[model samples]
Target: MITAKNPVHAALFLVLAFFSAGGIWMLLHAEFLAIALVMVYVGAVMVLFLFVVMMLDINLERIRQGFWSYLPIGALIGILMLAEMVVVLGSRYFGLEHVPQPAEFPAGYSNTKELGRLLYTDYVYPFELASIVLLVAMIAAVALTLRKRKSVKALDPAKQIAVKRDDRVRIVSMDAEKK
Candidate 1:
């Protein structure tokens, strides 16, 4: 029985289902679509879900507080979004009488290779821009959390390297005759 209490397990189940479906799609020769679904939804979206569930300290009471107030608006937005998606999908059936499928690539050509080539060649600028954006985001995240504390002692690598053994260690033998 699937329940809300075990969201991580439920998400894992969903991820497995998606991966299985993607494999089936690949077997059916829809490699592009299967790879997209697996990479975007399974890899990115599901991982994000797992990370959020694991990392965030969720306040159930705060979430519930505005539920009643937002119910109508949320429902209305959801219905509108669903209607839009239905219309957009249905238009493909009604408007397009017949769309020609591209000829299959040669047996030697790989789908993954073709996708990589396209991303690197045709979409190079966009790909580079996306990478830069991600780099900036990473830097921003590090900057946000990074801080220096006066109370904490920090190791200086140069100082440690420069120190002689005698500065840090000592060995002594005392004469027993003095006692």
Candidate 2:
């Protein structure tokens, strides 16, 4: 995806990456997380991304021109992420000996319920904050797309509702059907 020239292809690669990560979660017995990852990121987010890429008029030439200018910042971000990952993976807690395998649950136990319990109870504030952030993003996207265009005509509901019969129609008495 890093080397993909097309933005659409890059987004598709991201979907593949999400699927792979979800598969890994499934292997680790995180069924709820795996399904959530596939459903939310792959099903919803990637479809939105694909729609955006298809609808937008992107100039490849302009993108290529700005590549060099963006490279430095991109590389800095990549390096920072790499360093963070390395630190986390190299931590003692991540070692096999330090990490214990989770005990198998009974057949009737539901991972989804447990996850929801934890999310709504212990992490309610963060969950609400994420929802607010998503709501803001959705509103911002709508606002961005609703830019004023002189060529496009729109009706005001207030004006429409305020109109009286006398304002919209003129009655003609003498000029009626002089066939």
**Best candidate (score: TM-score):** 2
lDDT of each: 0.80, 0.89
* lDDT for each residue of candidate 1 in 3-67, tens digit (9 for 90 to 100): 33455777888898899989987775668879899999998999999998778787657656766
Off by over 4 Å in 1: 1-65, 92-109, 171-173, 177-179
TM-score per candidate, in order?
A: 0.64, 0.66
lDDT of 2 by residue, 9-52 (tens): 98999999999999998876679999999999999999999999
TM-score of 1: 0.64
Question: By how many angstroms RMSD does model 2 differ from the true structure?
Answer: 4.1
User: Local error of candidate 2 at 155, Å?
Assistant: 4.1
Q: What TM-score does model 2 achieve against the real structure?
A: 0.66
- What is the lDDT for 14 in model 1? 84
The whole-model C-alpha lDDT of candidate 1 against the native structure comes to 0.80
